[model samples]
Target: MSTTTMKYAVTDSLMMLRRSMLHIARYPSMTLPLIIGPIVFLFLFVYVFGGTLGAGLDGSSGGRADYVNYVTPGILLLTVAGAATATAVSVATDMTQGIVARFRTMSIFRPSLLTGHVLGSVIQTLLSVAVVLGVAVAIGFRPNANPAEWLAAVGILTMLIFAITWVAVIMGLVSDTVETASNLPMLLMLLPFFGSGFVPTDSMPGWLAAIAENQPFTPVMETLRGLLMGTEMGNSPWIAMAWCAGITAAAFAGSVALLNREPGR
Candidate 1:
Protein backbone atom coordinates (compact mmCIF):
# COMPACT_ATOMS: atom_id res chain seq x y z
CA MET A 1 0.00 0.00 0.00
CA SER A 2 1.12 3.58 -0.65
CA THR A 3 2.08 5.77 2.30
CA THR A 4 -0.98 7.98 1.73
CA THR A 5 -3.26 4.97 1.60
CA MET A 6 -1.68 3.46 4.70
CA LYS A 7 -2.22 6.69 6.57
CA TYR A 8 -5.86 6.74 5.55
CA ALA A 9 -6.33 3.16 6.66
CA VAL A 10 -4.81 3.87 10.03
CA THR A 11 -6.88 6.98 10.52
CA ASP A 12 -10.10 5.25 9.60
CA SER A 13 -9.37 2.21 11.77
CA LEU A 14 -8.68 4.43 14.75
CA MET A 15 -11.95 6.27 14.28
CA MET A 16 -13.84 3.00 14.00
CA LEU A 17 -12.07 1.69 17.07
CA ARG A 18 -13.16 4.78 18.98
CA ARG A 19 -16.70 4.11 17.82
CA SER A 20 -16.47 0.53 19.12
CA MET A 21 -15.17 1.70 22.49
CA LEU A 22 -18.00 4.18 22.75
CA HIS A 23 -20.54 1.50 21.96
CA ILE A 24 -18.99 -0.66 24.67
CA ALA A 25 -19.21 2.20 27.14
CA ARG A 26 -22.84 2.89 26.30
CA TYR A 27 -23.87 -0.77 26.33
CA PRO A 28 -21.98 -2.00 29.34
CA SER A 29 -24.39 -4.90 29.50
CA MET A 30 -22.68 -6.60 26.55
CA THR A 31 -19.29 -6.64 28.31
CA LEU A 32 -20.43 -7.55 31.81
CA PRO A 33 -21.39 -11.11 30.93
CA LEU A 34 -17.91 -11.70 29.54
CA ILE A 35 -16.39 -10.89 32.95
CA ILE A 36 -19.12 -12.29 35.19
CA GLY A 37 -19.48 -15.67 33.47
CA PRO A 38 -15.83 -16.60 33.93
CA ILE A 39 -15.82 -15.43 37.52
CA VAL A 40 -18.85 -17.52 38.28
CA PHE A 41 -17.13 -20.58 36.84
CA LEU A 42 -14.01 -19.83 38.84
CA PHE A 43 -15.94 -19.54 42.05
CA LEU A 44 -18.16 -22.52 41.29
CA PHE A 45 -15.28 -24.86 40.50
CA VAL A 46 -13.07 -23.66 43.33
CA TYR A 47 -15.67 -23.71 46.07
CA VAL A 48 -17.89 -26.57 45.05
CA PHE A 49 -15.80 -29.08 43.11
CA GLY A 50 -12.24 -28.20 44.05
CA GLY A 51 -11.61 -30.81 46.70
CA THR A 52 -12.66 -33.82 44.71
CA LEU A 53 -11.11 -32.53 41.51
CA GLY A 54 -7.85 -31.68 43.28
CA ALA A 55 -7.64 -35.24 44.53
CA GLY A 56 -7.92 -36.47 40.96
CA LEU A 57 -4.76 -34.68 39.88
CA ASP A 58 -1.50 -36.64 39.80
CA GLY A 59 -0.43 -35.15 43.11
CA SER A 60 -2.60 -33.31 45.57
CA SER A 61 -4.21 -33.50 48.99
CA GLY A 62 -7.71 -32.73 47.80
CA GLY A 63 -7.72 -29.01 48.63
CA ARG A 64 -9.45 -26.03 47.05
CA ALA A 65 -6.14 -24.15 46.89
CA ASP A 66 -4.60 -26.90 44.82
CA TYR A 67 -7.52 -26.89 42.40
CA VAL A 68 -7.38 -23.11 42.17
CA ASN A 69 -3.91 -23.33 40.69
CA TYR A 70 -4.88 -26.24 38.47
CA VAL A 71 -8.05 -24.74 37.05
CA THR A 72 -6.98 -21.11 36.49
CA PRO A 73 -5.62 -21.49 32.95
CA GLY A 74 -8.90 -22.99 31.81
CA ILE A 75 -10.88 -20.20 33.42
CA LEU A 76 -8.72 -17.63 31.66
CA LEU A 77 -9.45 -19.26 28.32
CA LEU A 78 -13.13 -19.11 29.15
CA THR A 79 -12.81 -15.36 29.39
CA VAL A 80 -11.36 -15.24 25.89
CA ALA A 81 -14.17 -17.44 24.61
CA GLY A 82 -16.77 -15.12 26.06
CA ALA A 83 -15.17 -12.08 24.45
CA ALA A 84 -15.00 -13.79 21.07
CA THR A 85 -18.69 -14.63 21.25
CA ALA A 86 -19.51 -11.06 22.09
CA THR A 87 -17.47 -9.80 19.15
CA ALA A 88 -19.44 -12.02 16.79
CA VAL A 89 -22.67 -10.63 18.09
CA SER A 90 -21.43 -7.06 17.82
CA VAL A 91 -20.16 -7.54 14.28
CA ALA A 92 -23.34 -9.26 13.20
CA THR A 93 -25.38 -6.45 14.65
CA ASP A 94 -23.46 -3.92 12.58
CA MET A 95 -23.80 -6.04 9.46
CA THR A 96 -27.54 -6.49 9.83
CA GLN A 97 -28.36 -3.05 11.18
CA GLY A 98 -27.48 -1.33 7.85
CA ILE A 99 -24.44 0.43 9.34
CA VAL A 100 -22.06 -1.56 7.16
CA ALA A 101 -24.00 -0.55 4.06
CA ARG A 102 -23.82 3.04 5.16
CA PHE A 103 -20.09 2.77 5.76
CA ARG A 104 -19.50 1.33 2.29
CA THR A 105 -21.02 4.41 0.69
CA MET A 106 -18.60 6.66 2.57
CA SER A 107 -14.99 7.56 1.62
CA ILE A 108 -13.35 5.81 4.60
CA PHE A 109 -11.11 2.75 4.24
CA ARG A 110 -13.34 -0.31 3.95
CA PRO A 111 -11.30 -2.86 5.87
CA SER A 112 -11.15 -0.52 8.84
CA LEU A 113 -14.63 -1.55 9.85
CA LEU A 114 -13.50 -5.10 10.52
CA THR A 115 -10.14 -3.91 11.79
CA GLY A 116 -11.84 -1.80 14.40
CA HIS A 117 -13.85 -4.72 15.69
CA VAL A 118 -10.82 -7.02 15.88
CA LEU A 119 -8.64 -4.45 17.62
CA GLY A 120 -11.40 -3.39 19.94
CA SER A 121 -12.19 -6.99 20.82
CA VAL A 122 -8.53 -7.67 21.61
CA ILE A 123 -8.28 -4.66 23.92
CA GLN A 124 -11.53 -5.46 25.67
CA THR A 125 -10.65 -9.14 26.00
CA LEU A 126 -7.31 -8.34 27.58
CA LEU A 127 -8.97 -6.10 30.13
CA SER A 128 -11.44 -8.85 30.95
CA VAL A 129 -8.55 -11.28 31.35
CA ALA A 130 -6.91 -8.96 33.86
CA VAL A 131 -10.09 -8.65 35.85
CA VAL A 132 -10.55 -12.42 35.89
CA LEU A 133 -6.93 -12.92 36.87
CA GLY A 134 -7.34 -10.51 39.76
CA VAL A 135 -10.36 -12.42 40.97
CA ALA A 136 -8.47 -15.67 40.61
CA VAL A 137 -5.63 -14.33 42.72
CA ALA A 138 -8.08 -13.19 45.35
CA ILE A 139 -9.59 -16.65 45.48
CA GLY A 140 -6.22 -18.34 46.21
CA PHE A 141 -4.97 -18.75 42.65
CA ARG A 142 -1.22 -18.17 42.63
CA PRO A 143 1.39 -18.29 39.87
CA ASN A 144 5.13 -18.71 40.30
CA ALA A 145 5.86 -17.03 36.96
CA ASN A 146 8.53 -14.35 36.96
CA PRO A 147 8.10 -11.01 35.22
CA ALA A 148 9.40 -12.37 31.94
CA GLU A 149 7.18 -15.43 32.09
CA TRP A 150 4.20 -13.25 32.92
CA LEU A 151 4.98 -11.11 29.90
CA ALA A 152 5.29 -14.17 27.69
CA ALA A 153 1.97 -15.47 29.00
CA VAL A 154 0.34 -12.17 28.15
CA GLY A 155 1.92 -12.20 24.70
CA ILE A 156 0.52 -15.61 23.88
CA LEU A 157 -2.87 -14.59 25.20
CA THR A 158 -2.89 -11.46 23.03
CA MET A 159 -2.04 -13.55 20.00
CA LEU A 160 -4.79 -15.99 20.80
CA ILE A 161 -7.29 -13.21 21.29
CA PHE A 162 -6.37 -11.54 18.03
CA ALA A 163 -6.66 -14.78 16.14
CA ILE A 164 -9.99 -15.75 17.68
CA THR A 165 -11.41 -12.29 17.18
CA TRP A 166 -10.86 -12.63 13.45
CA VAL A 167 -12.55 -15.99 13.54
CA ALA A 168 -15.46 -14.35 15.33
CA VAL A 169 -15.51 -11.65 12.69
CA ILE A 170 -15.98 -14.26 10.01
CA MET A 171 -18.70 -15.88 12.07
CA GLY A 172 -20.47 -12.56 12.12
CA LEU A 173 -19.94 -11.92 8.43
CA VAL A 174 -21.68 -15.07 7.24
CA SER A 175 -24.44 -14.95 9.80
CA ASP A 176 -27.85 -13.92 8.50
CA THR A 177 -28.99 -12.61 11.86
CA VAL A 178 -27.53 -11.53 15.16
CA GLU A 179 -28.93 -14.59 16.89
CA THR A 180 -27.14 -16.95 14.52
CA ALA A 181 -23.90 -15.08 15.05
CA SER A 182 -24.19 -15.44 18.80
CA ASN A 183 -25.03 -19.14 18.56
CA LEU A 184 -22.30 -19.97 16.03
CA PRO A 185 -19.47 -18.90 18.30
CA MET A 186 -20.77 -20.88 21.25
CA LEU A 187 -18.56 -23.77 20.17
CA LEU A 188 -15.53 -21.70 21.10
CA MET A 189 -16.71 -21.78 24.68
CA LEU A 190 -17.07 -25.55 24.68
CA LEU A 191 -13.57 -26.17 23.30
CA PRO A 192 -11.85 -25.79 26.67
CA PHE A 193 -14.07 -28.32 28.39
CA PHE A 194 -13.30 -30.82 25.64
CA GLY A 195 -9.63 -30.09 26.16
CA SER A 196 -7.62 -29.93 29.45
CA GLY A 197 -9.73 -27.19 30.98
CA PHE A 198 -11.66 -28.98 33.68
CA VAL A 199 -9.79 -32.30 34.14
CA PRO A 200 -6.62 -34.04 33.07
CA THR A 201 -6.66 -35.92 29.78
CA ASP A 202 -5.49 -39.07 31.50
CA SER A 203 -8.46 -38.81 33.78
CA MET A 204 -10.71 -39.57 30.84
CA PRO A 205 -11.30 -42.80 28.98
CA GLY A 206 -9.02 -43.69 26.07
CA TRP A 207 -11.04 -42.10 23.26
CA LEU A 208 -11.99 -38.98 25.16
CA ALA A 209 -8.44 -38.62 26.49
CA ALA A 210 -7.08 -38.71 22.95
CA ILE A 211 -9.44 -35.95 21.92
CA ALA A 212 -8.40 -33.78 24.85
CA GLU A 213 -4.69 -34.31 24.23
CA ASN A 214 -4.77 -33.27 20.56
CA GLN A 215 -7.08 -30.27 20.38
CA PRO A 216 -5.85 -26.67 19.95
CA PHE A 217 -6.98 -25.39 23.33
CA THR A 218 -5.19 -28.20 25.19
CA PRO A 219 -1.76 -27.04 24.04
CA VAL A 220 -2.63 -23.43 24.80
CA MET A 221 -3.92 -24.36 28.23
CA GLU A 222 -0.88 -26.53 28.89
CA THR A 223 1.42 -23.72 27.83
CA LEU A 224 -0.33 -21.30 30.20
CA ARG A 225 -0.31 -23.81 33.04
CA GLY A 226 3.36 -24.56 32.55
CA LEU A 227 4.30 -20.88 32.38
CA LEU A 228 2.34 -20.06 35.53
CA MET A 229 2.83 -23.12 37.75
CA GLY A 230 6.23 -24.41 36.58
CA THR A 231 4.75 -27.58 35.14
CA GLU A 232 6.28 -29.62 32.37
CA MET A 233 5.91 -27.57 29.19
CA GLY A 234 7.35 -29.99 26.68
CA ASN A 235 6.54 -28.49 23.25
CA SER A 236 3.28 -26.86 24.25
CA PRO A 237 4.43 -23.23 24.00
CA TRP A 238 5.57 -23.55 20.38
CA ILE A 239 2.57 -25.65 19.48
CA ALA A 240 0.21 -23.13 20.95
CA MET A 241 1.76 -20.21 19.08
CA ALA A 242 1.68 -22.19 15.84
CA TRP A 243 -2.04 -22.68 16.31
CA CYS A 244 -2.52 -18.99 16.98
CA ALA A 245 -0.51 -17.93 13.95
CA GLY A 246 -2.28 -20.34 11.64
CA ILE A 247 -5.68 -19.34 12.89
CA THR A 248 -4.89 -15.63 12.65
CA ALA A 249 -3.66 -15.89 9.10
CA ALA A 250 -6.56 -17.99 7.90
CA ALA A 251 -9.22 -16.07 9.76
CA PHE A 252 -7.83 -12.68 8.76
CA ALA A 253 -7.88 -13.65 5.10
CA GLY A 254 -11.33 -15.14 5.38
CA SER A 255 -12.82 -12.11 7.13
CA VAL A 256 -11.38 -9.67 4.61
CA ALA A 257 -12.55 -11.79 1.71
CA LEU A 258 -16.00 -12.13 3.14
CA LEU A 259 -16.32 -8.41 3.66
CA ASN A 260 -15.07 -7.62 0.19
CA ARG A 261 -17.31 -10.22 -1.44
CA GLU A 262 -20.64 -8.62 -0.59
CA PRO A 263 -21.08 -4.92 0.07
CA GLY A 264 -23.33 -5.29 3.08
CA ARG A 265 -22.83 -8.78 4.39
Candidate 2:
Protein backbone atom coordinates (compact mmCIF):
# COMPACT_ATOMS: atom_id res chain seq x y z
CA MET A 1 0.00 0.00 0.00
CA SER A 2 1.09 3.59 -0.74
CA THR A 3 1.60 6.20 1.99
CA THR A 4 -1.83 7.74 1.41
CA THR A 5 -3.55 4.38 1.42
CA MET A 6 -1.73 3.31 4.53
CA LYS A 7 -2.69 6.56 6.23
CA TYR A 8 -6.31 6.05 5.25
CA ALA A 9 -6.25 2.51 6.63
CA VAL A 10 -4.86 3.71 9.93
CA THR A 11 -7.44 6.47 10.12
CA ASP A 12 -10.23 4.08 9.32
CA SER A 13 -8.96 1.65 11.95
CA LEU A 14 -8.96 4.39 14.58
CA MET A 15 -12.52 5.29 13.72
CA MET A 16 -13.55 1.67 13.98
CA LEU A 17 -11.68 1.44 17.27
CA ARG A 18 -13.61 4.41 18.56
CA ARG A 19 -16.86 2.72 17.60
CA SER A 20 -15.90 -0.43 19.52
CA MET A 21 -14.83 1.62 22.55
CA LEU A 22 -18.17 3.39 22.54
CA HIS A 23 -19.94 0.05 22.57
CA ILE A 24 -17.95 -0.85 25.68
CA ALA A 25 -18.61 2.49 27.37
CA ARG A 26 -22.32 2.23 26.69
CA TYR A 27 -22.55 -1.29 28.09
CA PRO A 28 -21.18 -1.33 31.59
CA SER A 29 -22.54 -4.85 32.15
CA MET A 30 -20.19 -6.14 29.48
CA THR A 31 -17.15 -4.84 31.38
CA LEU A 32 -18.28 -5.32 34.97
CA PRO A 33 -17.75 -9.10 35.04
CA LEU A 34 -14.30 -8.76 33.53
CA ILE A 35 -13.30 -6.48 36.40
CA ILE A 36 -15.13 -8.23 39.21
CA GLY A 37 -14.54 -11.92 38.47
CA PRO A 38 -10.76 -11.77 38.77
CA ILE A 39 -10.98 -9.71 41.92
CA VAL A 40 -13.21 -12.37 43.44
CA PHE A 41 -10.80 -15.12 42.41
CA LEU A 42 -7.88 -13.17 43.87
CA PHE A 43 -9.65 -12.86 47.19
CA LEU A 44 -10.74 -16.48 47.21
CA PHE A 45 -7.26 -17.80 46.48
CA VAL A 46 -5.39 -15.47 48.84
CA TYR A 47 -7.79 -15.71 51.75
CA VAL A 48 -9.16 -19.26 51.55
CA PHE A 49 -6.52 -21.37 49.80
CA GLY A 50 -3.53 -19.21 50.64
CA GLY A 51 -2.70 -20.85 53.97
CA THR A 52 -2.80 -24.48 52.80
CA LEU A 53 -1.68 -24.14 49.20
CA GLY A 54 0.94 -21.68 50.39
CA ALA A 55 2.56 -24.43 52.41
CA GLY A 56 2.67 -26.79 49.43
CA LEU A 57 4.02 -24.23 46.96
CA ASP A 58 6.49 -22.68 49.38
CA GLY A 59 7.94 -23.98 52.61
CA SER A 60 7.31 -22.23 55.97
CA SER A 61 9.81 -19.46 55.23
CA GLY A 62 8.24 -18.42 51.90
CA GLY A 63 4.61 -19.21 52.99
CA ARG A 64 1.95 -16.59 52.22
CA ALA A 65 4.21 -14.31 50.21
CA ASP A 66 4.85 -17.09 47.75
CA TYR A 67 1.17 -17.81 47.24
CA VAL A 68 0.37 -14.14 46.73
CA ASN A 69 3.16 -13.72 44.21
CA TYR A 70 2.39 -16.96 42.36
CA VAL A 71 -1.35 -16.34 42.01
CA THR A 72 -1.04 -12.72 40.79
CA PRO A 73 0.44 -13.53 37.37
CA GLY A 74 -2.06 -16.31 36.77
CA ILE A 75 -4.99 -14.03 37.58
CA LEU A 76 -3.52 -11.40 35.29
CA LEU A 77 -3.55 -13.83 32.36
CA LEU A 78 -7.13 -14.81 33.21
CA THR A 79 -8.08 -11.16 32.92
CA VAL A 80 -6.75 -11.21 29.35
CA ALA A 81 -9.07 -14.13 28.52
CA GLY A 82 -12.03 -12.29 30.00
CA ALA A 83 -11.46 -9.33 27.69
CA ALA A 84 -10.97 -11.59 24.67
CA THR A 85 -14.22 -13.45 25.40
CA ALA A 86 -16.03 -10.13 25.46
CA THR A 87 -14.58 -9.29 22.04
CA ALA A 88 -15.61 -12.70 20.76
CA VAL A 89 -19.17 -12.03 21.87
CA SER A 90 -19.06 -8.58 20.26
CA VAL A 91 -17.71 -9.96 16.99
CA ALA A 92 -20.26 -12.76 16.98
CA THR A 93 -23.06 -10.29 17.60
CA ASP A 94 -21.74 -8.12 14.78
CA MET A 95 -21.67 -11.03 12.39
CA THR A 96 -25.24 -11.99 13.20
CA GLN A 97 -26.55 -8.43 12.97
CA GLY A 98 -27.84 -6.72 9.84
CA ILE A 99 -25.38 -3.84 10.32
CA VAL A 100 -22.55 -6.09 9.15
CA ALA A 101 -24.33 -6.63 5.85
CA ARG A 102 -24.72 -2.87 5.53
CA PHE A 103 -21.00 -2.38 6.12
CA ARG A 104 -20.20 -5.02 3.55
CA THR A 105 -21.83 -2.92 0.85
CA MET A 106 -19.97 0.21 1.86
CA SER A 107 -16.59 1.50 0.57
CA ILE A 108 -14.91 1.18 3.98
CA PHE A 109 -11.77 -0.87 4.73
CA ARG A 110 -13.10 -4.16 6.14
CA PRO A 111 -9.91 -5.10 7.91
CA SER A 112 -10.28 -2.00 10.06
CA LEU A 113 -13.34 -3.49 11.72
CA LEU A 114 -11.50 -6.56 13.00
CA THR A 115 -8.41 -4.47 13.81
CA GLY A 116 -10.55 -2.07 15.78
CA HIS A 117 -12.15 -4.85 17.81
CA VAL A 118 -8.74 -6.40 18.49
CA LEU A 119 -7.21 -3.08 19.60
CA GLY A 120 -10.18 -2.22 21.73
CA SER A 121 -10.11 -5.65 23.37
CA VAL A 122 -6.39 -5.35 24.11
CA ILE A 123 -6.89 -1.97 25.76
CA GLN A 124 -9.74 -3.34 27.83
CA THR A 125 -7.69 -6.42 28.77
CA LEU A 126 -4.77 -4.27 29.94
CA LEU A 127 -7.11 -2.15 32.00
CA SER A 128 -8.66 -5.25 33.59
CA VAL A 129 -5.18 -6.65 34.31
CA ALA A 130 -4.23 -3.41 36.02
CA VAL A 131 -7.35 -3.59 38.13
CA VAL A 132 -6.50 -7.16 39.15
CA LEU A 133 -2.94 -6.09 39.92
CA GLY A 134 -4.26 -3.30 42.07
CA VAL A 135 -6.39 -5.77 43.98
CA ALA A 136 -3.37 -8.02 44.40
CA VAL A 137 -1.37 -5.09 45.73
CA ALA A 138 -4.15 -4.21 48.18
CA ILE A 139 -3.62 -7.68 49.54
CA GLY A 140 -0.07 -8.89 50.43
CA PHE A 141 1.18 -9.50 46.88
CA ARG A 142 4.58 -7.98 46.17
CA PRO A 143 7.12 -8.42 43.36
CA ASN A 144 10.80 -7.45 43.20
CA ALA A 145 10.76 -6.57 39.51
CA ASN A 146 12.79 -3.51 38.54
CA PRO A 147 11.76 -0.94 35.91
CA ALA A 148 13.30 -2.84 32.98
CA GLU A 149 11.79 -6.10 34.16
CA TRP A 150 8.42 -4.39 34.47
CA LEU A 151 8.69 -3.25 30.85
CA ALA A 152 9.49 -6.78 29.73
CA ALA A 153 6.51 -8.10 31.70
CA VAL A 154 4.22 -5.64 29.97
CA GLY A 155 5.62 -6.67 26.58
CA ILE A 156 4.93 -10.34 27.35
CA LEU A 157 1.38 -9.53 28.41
CA THR A 158 0.73 -7.47 25.27
CA MET A 159 1.77 -10.42 23.11
CA LEU A 160 -0.56 -12.68 25.12
CA ILE A 161 -3.44 -10.26 24.72
CA PHE A 162 -2.79 -9.99 20.97
CA ALA A 163 -2.46 -13.74 20.58
CA ILE A 164 -5.60 -14.69 22.48
CA THR A 165 -7.80 -11.94 21.03
CA TRP A 166 -7.23 -13.31 17.55
CA VAL A 167 -8.17 -16.79 18.71
CA ALA A 168 -11.32 -15.27 20.19
CA VAL A 169 -11.93 -13.46 16.88
CA ILE A 170 -11.72 -16.70 14.94
CA MET A 171 -13.98 -18.42 17.44
CA GLY A 172 -16.47 -15.64 16.96
CA LEU A 173 -16.25 -16.07 13.19
CA VAL A 174 -16.76 -19.81 13.30
CA SER A 175 -19.62 -19.84 15.77
CA ASP A 176 -23.16 -19.40 14.47
CA THR A 177 -24.27 -17.52 17.59
CA VAL A 178 -22.86 -15.12 20.15
CA GLU A 179 -23.47 -17.60 22.97
CA THR A 180 -21.37 -20.25 21.25
CA ALA A 181 -18.59 -17.77 20.57
CA SER A 182 -18.41 -16.71 24.23
CA ASN A 183 -18.06 -20.32 25.47
CA LEU A 184 -14.78 -21.08 23.69
CA PRO A 185 -12.80 -18.36 25.42
CA MET A 186 -14.36 -19.30 28.74
CA LEU A 187 -12.89 -22.78 28.20
CA LEU A 188 -9.55 -21.07 27.59
CA MET A 189 -9.85 -19.29 30.94
CA LEU A 190 -9.66 -22.68 32.65
CA LEU A 191 -6.22 -23.33 31.11
CA PRO A 192 -4.38 -21.45 33.86
CA PHE A 193 -5.94 -23.56 36.61
CA PHE A 194 -4.71 -26.79 35.05
CA GLY A 195 -1.21 -25.48 34.31
CA SER A 196 1.53 -24.38 36.67
CA GLY A 197 -0.32 -21.15 37.39
CA PHE A 198 -1.52 -21.48 40.96
CA VAL A 199 0.94 -24.21 42.01
CA PRO A 200 4.21 -25.91 41.04
CA THR A 201 4.13 -28.65 38.41
CA ASP A 202 6.35 -31.00 40.39
CA SER A 203 3.69 -31.49 43.04
CA MET A 204 1.25 -32.81 40.43
CA PRO A 205 1.10 -36.51 39.56
CA GLY A 206 3.67 -37.68 37.01
CA TRP A 207 1.35 -37.69 33.99
CA LEU A 208 -0.39 -34.46 35.00
CA ALA A 209 2.98 -32.88 35.71
CA ALA A 210 4.16 -33.79 32.25
CA ILE A 211 1.13 -32.13 30.69
CA ALA A 212 1.34 -29.01 32.84
CA GLU A 213 5.09 -28.62 32.26
CA ASN A 214 4.73 -28.77 28.48
CA GLN A 215 1.61 -26.63 27.98
CA PRO A 216 1.57 -22.98 26.79
CA PHE A 217 0.01 -21.51 29.95
CA THR A 218 2.70 -22.99 32.18
CA PRO A 219 5.43 -21.37 30.07
CA VAL A 220 3.67 -18.02 30.16
CA MET A 221 3.02 -18.16 33.90
CA GLU A 222 6.63 -19.25 34.44
CA THR A 223 7.92 -16.38 32.32
CA LEU A 224 5.77 -13.85 34.17
CA ARG A 225 6.77 -15.26 37.55
CA GLY A 226 10.44 -15.13 36.52
CA LEU A 227 10.10 -11.53 35.40
CA LEU A 228 8.25 -10.34 38.51
CA MET A 229 9.73 -12.42 41.34
CA GLY A 230 13.25 -12.68 39.84
CA THR A 231 13.03 -16.44 39.53
CA GLU A 232 15.15 -18.33 36.99
CA MET A 233 12.91 -18.83 33.91
CA GLY A 234 15.30 -20.98 31.84
CA ASN A 235 13.83 -21.28 28.32
CA SER A 236 10.31 -20.24 29.38
CA PRO A 237 10.70 -16.77 27.87
CA TRP A 238 11.59 -18.26 24.48
CA ILE A 239 8.91 -20.96 24.71
CA ALA A 240 6.26 -18.46 25.69
CA MET A 241 7.17 -16.19 22.81
CA ALA A 242 7.12 -19.11 20.36
CA TRP A 243 3.67 -20.21 21.54
CA CYS A 244 2.18 -16.74 21.32
CA ALA A 245 3.73 -16.02 17.92
CA GLY A 246 2.55 -19.28 16.39
CA ILE A 247 -0.98 -18.96 17.82
CA THR A 248 -1.32 -15.30 16.78
CA ALA A 249 -0.10 -15.98 13.23
CA ALA A 250 -2.34 -18.99 12.75
CA ALA A 251 -5.40 -17.32 14.26
CA PHE A 252 -4.91 -14.11 12.26
CA ALA A 253 -4.63 -16.03 9.00
CA GLY A 254 -7.72 -18.10 9.82
CA SER A 255 -9.73 -15.01 10.75
CA VAL A 256 -8.86 -13.21 7.48
CA ALA A 257 -9.65 -16.26 5.40
CA LEU A 258 -12.98 -16.80 7.10
CA LEU A 259 -13.86 -13.12 6.84
CA ASN A 260 -13.20 -13.13 3.09
CA ARG A 261 -15.32 -16.20 2.45
CA GLU A 262 -18.81 -15.72 1.05
CA PRO A 263 -21.67 -15.73 3.54
CA GLY A 264 -23.63 -18.56 1.91
CA ARG A 265 -20.59 -20.58 0.88
Top candidate (lDDT): 1
Clashing pairs in 1: none
Residue pairs of candidate 2 with colliding backbone atoms:
none
What does candidate 2 score on TM? 0.96
* Native-to-model Cα distance after best TM-score fit, residue 128 in candidate 1, in Å: 0.8
Model 2 clash tally, residue pairs:
0
Q: Write one digit per residue (lDDT tens) for candidate 2, span 182-252.
A: 88788888888888878888889999999888877888899998999988799999999999999999998
lDDT of each: 0.92, 0.87
The TM-scores of all predictions, comma-separated, are 0.97, 0.96
> Against the true structure, whose TM-score is highest?
1
TM-score of 1: 0.97
Please give the distance, in angstroms, between residue 250's alpha carbon in candidate 1 and its true position after superposition.
0.4
lDDT for residue 193 in candidate 2, whole number 0-100: 83
